[model samples]
Structures are given as structure tokens and as C-alpha cells.
Target: MTAAAPRPLPEWTASAVSPLDAKLGLELLEVSPERAVGRAPVAGNTQPFGLWHGGASCVLAESLGSLAAHAHALTLDLVAVGVDLNATHHRSAREGWVTGTATALRLGRTLASYEVVLTGDDGQRLCTARLTCSLVPPRR
Candidate 1:
């Protein structure tokens, strides 16, 4: 028998909102099962020292990775929840926006993992992160 065709990626809607994302001013550029891209400004997300907060970088990383994994799970009529996340801060950003890109490392039936990279406006790597998510059936 022929295998079934894969389901298409879900389209993101303006009404689909995340309060934390909105609070952080995250602007999503692209999202799919393969990757997710987004950006957040450093102006308000910085620490008292005026440098970008490492937590902000982790937030961006987790957002991208989680979104990508969720997109992958949707294809199977499932949902994803982050189980573990880790990040390494390499540099700092004092101004402008930091862009984050998350690429899938593994997309499996029960788990998904993604590598997320955060870069400054000048393309300098600011942080590297990895997120692992568990996929399960959505609550009825």
C-alpha cells in the first residue's frame, strides 16, 4: 500500500498569541517544522548593566526551538512540550535586535530536538542553545 502523504505545516495567525512573547516583543519571521526564525530588541531586554540579559537569549532560543518542535508535532496531530533546554552565552549585545534561528536536530515520533543560535545585528554569534521537547497526544 502507498504511504500516506504528509500533512502541511500549519499557518500562523495574528490572533495566535503568547503573552510572554508579546511581553518580550518577539517578532517571528518564519516558523516551520524544519526551522524557526525570530528577533527581539535589546533596548528593553537588557540587564541593569545595559547589556543584553542572558535570560533574554535563552528566552529567544527556547521560543524558536519550541515553536519549531510544535510545528513538527502538529503534522502528526500531536503537541510538544519542552523537557530540557540549555544555552551558552558567547557574547553580548547592548543595542539593536538579536536574531535567533532554530534548526531541527532530530524530529522523531516521541521526541524533538533543535539547535538555536542567537546573533547580533552584525552577525556575531551571541549565544548557542539546544532544546529537547516531548511529543504527545493533545488533550481532548
Candidate 2:
């Protein structure tokens, strides 16, 4: 007999993702359980001082990390919820897009963690962040 077709991946529509993601102009470039990438414009996500907002960096970091965690959780018929998030701002960006790359640090049965690095267009590190998500059964 022919092999069964592979299951389809989750579709990330605007409505399916966080509304804040749209508000911040964040766009997902890549997605997987091991890694995820996203970008946001520096113009609208700036602080009052005209520098990139640290909170925005945290948001991007958590978003990417959670995305990866969710992907992993899906395989186990579970859902992921972010439990903790930490970020360190190393520098500031005033222009161009801010890119965030998330690499999985751990993907355990109960939890998932990832480290996300936010960079400028010129490749300078703007911030570093870590996120942890707890996996749980989906509500019926």
C-alpha cells in the first residue's frame, strides 16, 4: 500500500498569531521546533528616546521562542504557554529592521526553552533574551 500523506503544518495567519505581533509590525521569516526567526521595524517600535524599545525586544523574543515551543508541543498533542521571559539590552537601534533569531535550548516533555538574539540590520546585537514555556494538554 502507498504511504499515508504527511500531516500539514500549522498555518500562521494574522488572526492565528498574537494581535500585538501585528501592532508591532513583526513578521515571521522562519519557523520550526528548533529555531524561529522574525523581524520588526524599528520606526514604530521605538521608545520615547527614539531608541528601540527594550519591551519590544522582549516581545519579539518571547514570541519566537513560544512559537518554537508550540511547534514542539503540537507533536506531543499538547499546547505551550510561556512561563518566563528574560531579556538584556546590549545596544540600541534607531533605524532599519530588528531581526530576532531564536534557537532552542531545551525541548523536554514538560517544558521548552529558547534563547533569542535580536540584531540590527548591520548585524549588531541589540538584545539577548530567553524564554521558557510549559507544555500542557489542550483544553477540550
Give the alpha-carbon lDDT of every model.
0.90, 0.89
Candidate 2 residue-wise lDDT, 1-140, digit = tens: 99775334358533446888888888887778898888999999999999999999998999889988988898899999999999999999999999999999999999999999999999999999999999999999
Estimated TM-score for each candidate: 0.90, 0.90
Candidate 1 lDDT for residue 137: 98
> Pairing residues by index, what is the TM-score of model 1?
0.90
lDDT of 1 at 138: 94
lDDT of candidate model 1 versus the reference: 0.90
Error of 1 at 119 (Å): 0.1
Stretches of model 1 off by over 4 angstroms after superposition: 1-10, 13-16
Runs in model 2 with CA error above 4 Å? Answer: 1-15
What range of 10 consecutive residues in model 1 has the weakest lDDT sum? 8-17
